[model samples]
Target: MTTLICTLQDHRDDVNWCAFSGNLLATCSGDKTLRVYSTSDFSELAFSPLSGHGYSVHCCCFSACGQFLASCSTDATVVIWSMVSGEIEAVLEHPGRSPVRICALSPDSVHLVSGASDGTLALWDFPSKQLCRTGTVNEATLVACSFSPCSQVFVTGSTYGDLRLWDLEMRQLHAEKNAHDLGVTCCTFAPSILSGGQVVQFRLASCGQDSQLKIWAINKFNFGGYKMHLLHTLTGQSAPVLSCAYSSDGQLLVSGSVDKTVTVYDANNALLLYTLNQHERYVTACCFSPTAPIIATGSMDKTVNIWRLEDGCRGRDGKSVPEQSALTSSEGRKKIYLPIHLCIS
Candidate 1:
């Protein structure tokens, strides 16, 4: 394997979110720019300066089909862009002291949900361009909001260290938990495909200011009735974990932290990988390629690094040795010599 690094040199300010869709990468930055890059060569594909946001773009994501892009910002608005034409399709505004921190589109792409600093969650109908419903959860500023992979449920975490689940159909609280000891910075639900046979399990991974990554499994159906079991708690970094994602295969999880490193762990909570000690700044975001063994990380150091997992050792019989066993034997030491280079652009 060969490793190639491509420095995205366009943003004048810090990048908040980097999203991948097909062969395209969409980066939202504080520079007021939304850049699209070709994944094949990391070449600039399109550059569009979005002006509606009064301040920094906080978060962005692509639609499931890659047809649309949604972004939230300190400007107190969320904008949906049409990927086909690179045009702004909708601009959602919230008045008063609320600044949208996170925005997510439903699986159907017909609705949108946003969490704001005002501690209110709003559900909007895309075509109608009207607020369909609103839920209040005191005055705890929301840090992140995500729709479950199945699209029937949504979860939001706030500064009060609470995670609340909402049911779209009834617009009611489906489940709630104090998921973290400190302000919850991020939360992600496991994919439905990982639970076998389409029966989606309500397992979620969350991280917070407490510097702990906790996995909570929700096993029941009634509102506030699900059992919360601690699957694992990862601790090591000196700083808080800001972002996390599970590999498509559900066997690995990657997390980025303000500690300036990215750590990859197996499903059993063993530390399987780590990288990025060269940069002396915070690692803001990280994600696994939807179809590759590559992991991409964005950092406050103003660079993105793409890393590939290398096969450690091959037995003389041409079979691969387990990573653990490879680390324990002399032959394994001889077989594992170098880190494979990954080709990035």
Candidate 2:
């Protein structure tokens, strides 16, 4: 096993989100800057300094086509940038008192959804540069928001433990429920392709301040309504699970935690694998590489570590051994490569 193959150090403040577009990586930080890096050599490619946000950047994402970058900050503004020119294309701001907590762009890049600290969710049309609709969630502060893969629906999770689904076209609430015991910090919908041939069997995963990870299967009941049933409850992390991501194949789930580790689990509730003591501090973000079998995790320790999916294979003593010498160097970095087959079950 090897440690991080590359390390990019440009953010002086807390790095909140790290996203990839092909071989390019985009990162947003409290330093009031958005940076783009080449994943091949971990070299800095472009630096766009943004100064409108008065507070820390909470989240950032790249559009599906990799042509635009969207970011939200505690200053309550969502800024959209053109990747080609590195210019701010649009700035979506709330009135005077709202603080934007999370933002997500639709797959088509025509619509954007954002949640605010005031428990309000807003939908914006990118082409028209206008707010299309707004709805009050009637809960505590909203923490996380996600758009469905189909781009027709969006969901927001609140600090009050409520998860509400909204239909973008009708601008009405489709479903609402208390999905967790503690405040939800992050939530994501599984890819539609992962459901096999069942279009209605959708899965949603959420993690909260309670340090528990829960997976729900949303299925239609006999005659009229939809029901959410808990499919799995993952335990063992000593701290809150701050972020989670599903593999492109949808067979594996990876989560970063305040416990200073990243845990990997199968689609079922089974514990397929885990990586401990990687970061010296809390892991703030994690994501699977778009093309490689790599998972990148950013930490409060001010560094990002890339772990190979093949690192889960164990030796005779039940310890994962380095499968390759690719990461062994005099730089004093650590690497663990477990075979990918161990995580498929």
lDDT of 2 by residue, 65-108 (tens): 88888888888889888878788888899544588888888767
Clashes of 2: 14
Best by lDDT: 2
Per-residue lDDT for 1-345 in model 1, tens only? 212233454566666777676666777777776777656655555545555567888788878788788888878888888878788888888645488888877666677888899888888886676878877767988887777777767888888888887877535454455677768888877664334342335667788888877777755443334345677888746688887776656666767788876666664454544434533367676666665566666666555555555531111221222333221112421212223233332
Candidate models: Cα lDDT each = 0.67, 0.69
TM-score of 1: 0.82
The superposed Cα distance between candidate 2 and the true structure at residue 168, in angstroms, equals 0.6
TM-score, predicted candidate 2 vs. hidden true structure: 0.84
